[model samples]
Target: METLRNWSSLCGYFVFIFLTTVSKDACFSEGSACEAPTSPECFTKNAIETVYNCEWSMNRTDGIVTFDLYFNSKTKFEVFNKTWHTIPEEKLIQRREVFIWVEAHVGNSSCSSPRRSVVLRDIVKYDAPQITSMSWSNSSLSLMWEAPEKHPALTEVWLRGDGHPAELRKETFTRINTDQVTVANLSQHSTHWVQIRQRSTQVKSPLWSNWSPWVKVPAELAHAPEVNVTTKRLNGTREVTLTWKLRSHAAAAAAGVTYQLSDTQSSLGCPCARTEKRRHYLF
Candidate 1:
């Protein structure tokens, strides 16, 4: 019983300390507004938007806490009763400085956050860029992605060779202003994977979008496969056999490889091709 009483006293002391610290750091006074949510951020997801979507974080204290947002002391902007709120396009002047703050109400007490100043046009975050096409030529990979047609943006391209250990794989990053980029000196023997992300160059402070899904780049054929041919005459007929070594290196690294054979005077058939056995290999 004595030990249980001591533990209870210790827990009570911790609770008292937490409340006192929270009151000092999170509240200005007994009735003052609570401190602003932590790391409040506002950003526009598209270039055509004149306002931003803002969000913040708050420690959920003892009661249900509802929030109200304001812009430059204007009328409450859509009391969403949540930590995140989107300002109406016509509510504030664009391309100009605006002050943003938040108010929190719990039970009968209310608290307001310090005002944060920002320029509506400067804080922008775009959506992930989409890959349109990709092609390989002369040991180089060229990729094209879709973005704002007229609004120039800076892009980052990430490329990694296929069929390699994570630590041993070669990866490359390229920064470019155009929507298309060409990376040279890649091996034609191995396939490649690539992803892209971008941010607006016109904005003073812009956030990069999340990376796009990784796209596969198949390996291009570097040269024709070598083969051995043998022929003999038997029973007034000619028989021929052609054999080639399968290349494990290129075949395993590539998405897939296939071969084709054609003759001008004779059409060869095989069991797999379902052609006449007399004119082609039976098996």
Candidate 2:
């Protein structure tokens, strides 16, 4: 009875070992005898039955990288060439660290050798900023913009305003850190063309994004319009022709000024008497 119990225990131990070995083998079978090449240096080069070279490219719009594998033979090429997973949207925008790997199958069979992992780390580029709102008042222009999707290590903005009369003046503000800027001392009653651009310090290279389209801002706010009114009697009618001239066309248009006319009644006792009749006209 003692010998039989010992034999049973030994058999159970052997069964456990066999099961573990089978599980590991099953996992290792996928990339059996397959290894990565060293040309790119992003992946590991190993001594195995088959070797492959890998190449990758970034898709800025989709925010993903497509990896392709080149094998010596057609059979290996068909099995290992596949796109990796799509990069996370937040990770791409934030320019965070990312890792990628691929499994190369050594033989024709899908499961053959242990899978080898390769990794690459990169910093994604950020998109350009966009202007959201703008306003001008009292010869001052205020602009607001939306920052890039990815938070840049350091952001620099550029603003430019071109005044009318070509030679009058051109103003530019550079290396501004904030998303909003107010430009003062602009010429009133004139149209000013404005544009903006931005760059990020997170990137290794020094590159500025494309400038935003030009926008026009008429500097006519806070200034009262100067208007001259004159009246002349017609040949033989009670109607009188009134003509007016505005010193500043831009200011008058922006202010939406309106004119009102009233005729006063004259009497013996009262030299001038106010009349209830009045006419309003928009200029």
Candidate 3:
């Protein structure tokens, strides 16, 4: 019985040492508020540099808390002897996952150590482009834009055109590593709407930016004659004479032009009918 009691005591001592060693290495206790760094939010990349900030907290008031930073499962450093540390740009650009933990030491007590681990997954993202200039000539439209602030290399741009007359032809342009694009074969004398968006192919799981605001190109200039109208009235009767003079100097000289005159009240109420009634006029 004595030998059995001694063996039992020796086993209990070994168990206590094992538990203490485990606690010393990783001391996170139950109910302790330890938060891991969040992905994307914890990592930021800009044109100049990429940075990572590791943050965590502990509930124990009697212990000193320190942090360990890791990248790709490799220990990088112990948070400069602090609870939070910022990984430099050089280290941040190499890895996608960041692991951090808090280590707390409470006085000389046996259960004084605690640890909590946090893992963050992040991907680098590129900025969105902005349209800079637009020009139109004949049936071709040209667009120019500035590249995104970050990850500008190997970018793909999408240009979309929306036109009037519902049945009007639609045009789309897709290009890589280019900042300017010209689209042709657009209908003459019709309004066209255009928008552009871009994404970078530099990283896995690339993110596409939101589409830019719509831009409008007004109806193309007509190559037809200009007309001046004059009205005359006789003093004795409800009779009027209207005369129109056509000027064919600039645009009309190259193309044949014809004109038609119609009374507003008889044909349609007003010029507003051209749009509201979908009236088609030939010149």
The RMSD of every model to the true structure, in order and in angstroms, is 12.5, 20.8, 16.8
Write down the lDDT that model 3 would get: 0.46
Rank list by TM-score: 1, 3, 2
TM-score of 2: 0.31
- Regions of model 3 farther than 4 Å from truth: 1-48, 51-124, 149-177, 221-283
TM-score of each: 0.52, 0.31, 0.35
For all candidates in order, the CA lDDT equals 0.64, 0.41, 0.46
lDDT of 1 by residue, 113-231 (tens): 66778877787877787776655567776677765535667777777767552623333343444577777787888767778787777778788777888766655444455879898
lDDT of 1 at 22: 43
lDDT for each residue of candidate 3 in 163-255, tens digit (9 for 90 to 100): 433443334444563477677776656555566665544544334555666555544332233445555566852343444444334322322
* Top-TM-score candidate index: 1
Of candidate 3, the 10-residue stretch with the lowest lDDT total is: 109-118
